[model samples]
Target: MTLPADITERLARLALPSQAVIDGAHVDALSGETFDNVSPRDGQLLNKVAACQKEDVALAVFAARTAFEDGRWRDQGPRAKKAVLFRLAELMERDADELALLESLDVGKPISDARNVDIPLAINTCRWYAEALDKVYGEVGASPVDRLSYAVHEPLGVIGAIVPWNFPLHMAMWKVAPALAMGNSVVLKPAEESPLTALKLGALALEAGLPAGVLNVVPGFGAVTGEALALSMDVDMIAFTGSGPVGRKLMEYSARSNLKRISLELGGKSPQIVFADCPDLEAAAQAAAWGVFYNQGEVCTAASRLLVEASIKEAFVERVAEVAKGMKVGDPLDPSTQFGAMVSERQMNTALGYIAIAGSQGARRVLGGGQVLKETGGFYVEPTIFDRLQPSHALAREEVFGPVLGVMSFTTEDEAIALANDTVYGLAAGLWTSDVNRALRGARRLKAGLVWVNGWDACDITMPFGGFKQSGFGRDRSLHALHKYADLKSVSVTLR
Candidate 1:
């Protein structure tokens, strides 16, 4: 795919920095190691960033610990923290275009999505958390006649956040915003594949008047920097968003360490059920395609398993296939491109491998199962669908984490619920029905942590987001996020 003229101009104008931020300053890896930032589009080199390891991770954790203990940030009033965060959000908005370009170039996401969805959501999250800082308060409890009692939340010192590459900026902010808003210092480890935006955020936070060492970015591979953060005894909490295996490893690290608080938001093979009672089959089909195909189906809450009523199975699948076919794939920088390259060659291969597995399993391919744009040297896969799916089939049970959908038919609500809840994953589920009773009942019965009725993957800062089973525990957004970053202390005093 040829780079558009405007994209070329932006690429020429933007200069991506390669160092990690520690104590509000850019620095090289202690071992002087670096890793290439390969653009999945056309397989070009974006830049080489510091490959932070145990030494750098130790430095960052120590900095955060010092900052927290100094009382510069942890003792700051809510209004002061709010002011700095608001400034940080403003700085992000000011550099929105540059951040978006870097995100698209580094993560293989379309520039439009980076600009319109990822960057804006990240900024709004910061602002939202900033506003929330002053609104929450401690509480006083009814006590014995001779005593007084109250409860207050206190910051948990230093926090470690390991974020994924799919939505690098937004995911980082999901951890950073609330943790900082609650007056905790943080060390963030961005995924190796996409570290540019997180580094940029660290710089912006410093420029926004965040105190030194309060927000540090360690850019490197997960095995090194991530593991170090997970195992760091100085860090009080570990908040991670990634695969289940890694999440489990972090939990183990916590157990082996100081038993610090651990919050994990992991994988999902979420189900979207379409009933004949849905008001509009066409809309449902369109939504289903968008739910699975958005972000190239890299979303944790993507509706990848489509369970349709037997009456509408054929029609819904056909319509969804058409919708998937209509989505364009090309250069991520192009404004018209709907789906861009996969994050890397390895990821594309993973998606293709899943397609091959489906074929071998005798699942019928409905549309798209092969590589697209083979001439471009980009990691691109066609939006794919597989039918003849049993609840136990690999395609239905496992998270393909690409634009692959598994289709099945159910005759009754009980069967639909059973098939939807069959997988160990319970991150999210979607159902479309005009019957309010069925919607309510299905939502209550779904094993997933989040249920969407007549909608899919719509999130608000107000809602708690997490999973029920192997998908991992603990929520990421809303007021619930504060719980992960602080300790609630109960106080009682005896009357003289």
Candidate 2:
């Protein structure tokens, strides 16, 4: 299909730097290995990035260790760190549009979303953690006679972060911001599918006054570079955002080594519950559509499971169907597009396979059961909806991580709560109701870490974000996230 005028302009305007930056120098991979970044929209080659390897990961970790031990970054006080972070936020804001375009091209998310939602939130995350660094308080205890006792927070040096492809830049910021704010250096490995923006951010961080070797970005395959980072004995902590199986492996590797401090934010199949008494059915329907379809429904907190009260199930399903039907799925750079292509050909095939499974399992297809606008050559799946699904159905239990929703009905409050908690993953859940008592009960009873009342997928930088159960542990945002990168030590001194 012909590209839209706006998309064409944006694509032509994007300028990718020729080399990857490492240790204050722009360089190529050690083996001269390279990988092509393809746009999901038309399978077009966007750019060629250095294909980093295990040796590269080791180099990155060593650089970070040196930065933490011998570099100026570790010697800077909390106030100085905050100032550097603030400057980083400013630089991010300045390059927002360019980064947004890169993110949209690399990940197949709408340019508008990359600009207005993802990039801004990422910058604000750094700014928020910057302000909180100096405010984190430690404990002081009463001592025995002629003794003084106090506690201090210290950084866990040389953190290793592995981020997924769906929101590459944003997830990188989520990991890097707090770790740097707490005085720890980082070695970041971006998913191979979407690594351009992360590499760009590495350069931008240097421009923002972050010292060289303090932050390193390596783009490579998971089995090679990613595994090396997780298994490295020199790395102090491992913070990862990815699938459950990989998270389990990371845990095992950490255990085998130094039992490194690990923080994982994994997959989810979150539920969006709509009660009969919801005051605004239209608003709930729209929120549900956006929650499930945004970024091609690749979000960890995507409301893939919709649990509606029996009385309102029919109407709510119809309303959501209407909204889904109206969404525009095409080129991501188009300003008018609401949805975009899936991240890659592999993800497209995976989503289609899930749809087939849903069909064979006897879930009724309410709307959008197939691909749309195939002439574009883009890996685009229709916004799909499956209704009358059983609680044990594969579609209901697993995270499709695509633009697909499974609808189920519940009779009572207990049933709704049970259905919501039925999944192994519990990253987030949404509750829409007019009754205050029911809302309160749902909020308390839901097993997920984040609960939205009368809305879905609405997040702020100040709120804590993580999951329970197989969805992984440890939070990402908020002041509490800073604690994940820090260690507490208590000291007692005798003064006679």
Clashes of each: 0, 0
Residue 213: error of model 1 in Å?
0.2
lDDT of 2 by residue, 1-496 (tens): 5667866776687787535567766678788898898988778888888888878888888889988998579789888898889998998899898899888888889888999988998898889889888888889898787888999988999999999989988899899999998899999889988888888888888988889999998888888888899889999999999999999999999999888988999999999999899879999999888889989999999999998999888888999999999998878888778899899989988899999999999999998877766787778999999999999899999888999999999989999999999989989998999999999999999999999999887778888999999999999988888899999999999997
What TM value does model 1 have? 0.99
Positional deviation of residue 69's Cα in model 1 after best superposition, in angstroms: 0.3
User: Each prediction's Cα RMSD?
Assistant: 0.9, 1.4
Best candidate according to lDDT: 1
Compute each candidate's TM-score over C-alphas.
Answer: 0.99, 0.97
> Which digits, one per residue and each the tens of the lDDT, describe model 1 over residues 1-496?
5677887888899989799999878999999999999998878888899999899999999999999999899888888899999999999999999999999989788999999999999999999999987766789989989999999988999999999999999999999999999999999999999999999999999999999999999999988899999889899999999999999899899999999889999999999999999987888999899999999988999899999999989978999999999999888889889999899999999999999999898899999998988787788898999988877678998888899999999999999999999999999998999999999999999999999999887668889989999989888999989877889999999999
lDDT of 2 at 487: 92
In candidate 1 the C-alpha lDDT for residue 15 amounts to 84
